[model samples]
Target: MDLLKRRLDIAHVIAREFLGIQEKGEQNLLECWLQEDERHRMEYEEIRQLLVAGEEAWKELEDGDLVAAACWQELQREEKRRSQWWVVWYRYASIVVLMLAVGIYYFAKQESPETIIHVETAAVTPGGGKAQLTLADGRKMQLDDTIRLTFKEVGGTDVSLEVGVVKYSGVDTADRKGAYNTLTVPRGGEFALVLADGTRIWLNSESSLKYPVAFTGNERRVEMTGEVYFEVARNAAAPFVVEVRDMDVRVLGTCFNVTAYGANVVTTLVEGSVRLNRGEEHITLSPDQQGTWNGDKFEMREVDAQSAVLWKEGIFYFENDPLEVILETMARWYDVGVFYADPELKNMHFSVKIKRYENINKILGIIAQTNRVRFEIKDRVINVYE
Candidate 1:
């Protein structure tokens, strides 16, 4: 308990320092703590550098902005209630505090009219449950949260759309032997589905999945691009396979997330076991393990597998990810484009947890607080600068 308190106290001190509100006593305490261990000093330096980077970025914005002045005033009021603020005490506390401090400083320092900057952009809304369903006969039907109905596929398979999910059922297995359906989730949209075999799938934005209307053989396979989370129904006799560009993930029944948006194909296992195969090279993954097939070789690593599927839960959780990677994800979900003025800024790393449904500006504001980067939205493109 004392150890935990000490860590929390250190976080508070560091946060105050980042906000430029640390008292003399807190500064002395932090200095003493820094002298106690080399690791502590290193941690402090790393966070300080990040904060400094943010400060430098803020200098790029134009002055006398109305929005910056309003934000500065609001943040000043928040600072008075700093003691009541929630302190997230964990291994990542230092990094989290750095983000908080940079954000607070970014707003707080804009109090002077000469330092304020104004930005104008159209409101960008969040993505929702929407997708395009293509039947075996190539008929396309649009699906969204508002639509609810039951329809029959060309192969006489019963397909239903209710509560944003497209489900396949009641098909004569013999008649719909090779009939296939595809769910295409476009940028700024997401969708869910239940296969005839009872496997549940959640597709992320800019993703597509092609599956059979009915299971008629010894194996069930689905071809997919982009990202998808699956909860395969248990079927010992018939194995389930997810086919990516160059690899296949085989499983009897399991819950896992597959990300195939780029050159790399990543499979994060949440429950049960999965075997990944590429040509003759194959690897098995256990729960909480992630397998990445980067065209040639496959690499495995242990991770918080559940974190990989947070998109299904309406959250964006990034852990020590680069700015470019994070923005790429945001671009897909928000259906926007990104351009960075300083390419080096793309390498800035951050850890963030934010609601997926929040306005794009709110998300950008949080990152802007870090002072590491400022964003300008024109048309539907997000321009980033250091």
Candidate 2:
């Protein structure tokens, strides 16, 4: 088979069929992705469609100069469908991209069940600010009520939501071993807290923080279920440990941010050093560094803390926000449903500066304005027009 030609055709098919984008012809897809503004949607679409088409046509081709744009289709199409075990073992990158590329293998074979993990830090149902505080006495406090009230004294941690910050102080830990209290932050809202250790924490929307009323044992450990930023109070003897999904974040009382949302958990260290452990894979990061726990692996890179903590500042600082990504942010903050009238809108990306108080419609409009796209808002859903 003509490998180069076949690979190009597969790429074309991926861009057009899977992603629902027609480059009008096969050759145009390569050009489009290379010059398709900055969203990189064109590239992503090309990869998706090509993978789909190649799955059917791969194995028939002979060897050639495995071009950058055409290598994946060649290998995937040529190889006979392997068991999901092999596919998973073969996967060496983040799950987001690799999972889709090796679609057949991911769900094809039956093996020992992989651990069922929850990376979602936030969950918002019909009601906004849908969170609860489980008192040590087995009493539950619903947080939707905006009126601040003293909830209960749960295990020496007086859990109270006063002016949105869940205060957990009043009671002392009595210097016991590892006794802890938990706080759950549901979707559509955020909570701040001052730990008895003097570490101030900011829990973003749809997140929870479980920590001991006082640091006990050999370490100060906290379990996380979403995103949180910490200005940790230092104690070398009691290093801070954050456990999320399958990774462990150990720090010596440094300021940092942890964002493990849905299959994507990222740990950004702002000061001092942090050791990031993903299963058996371990890597240490310094200030201004980041480690992203992809589906199957960990990716470490440097980052600007400003972009990571922009949400805490009450503004949407989207350096490059795609439509759906932007919509997720809006859905959480504005407490609304997200819908797209056209598939093309999903292909667009924006770099706009927006505030929290802006209405949903206005936010959508501003986003559309950036892309020269128009939108319609009814009820809580947004309809985009090309």
Question: Of the candidates shown, which would achieve the greatest lDDT relative to the real structure?
Answer: 1
lDDT per residue for candidate 2 within 3-100, as digits (tens), equals 23433454445434444444566546545644644434544554445455553323222232233225455335534587654443222111223323
Error of 2 at 131 (Å): 4.4
Local distance difference test, per candidate? 0.81, 0.63
What's the lDDT of the predicted structure labeled candidate 1? 0.81
Candidate 2 runs further than 4 Å off: 1-131, 144-161, 170-179
Please provide, for model 1 over 38-80, each residue's C-alpha lDDT reduced to its tens digit, 9 standing for 90 to 100. 6567767766675466534222221344444444455556656
- What global local distance difference test value does model 2 have? 0.63
Runs in model 1 with CA error above 4 Å? Answer: 1-107, 111-121
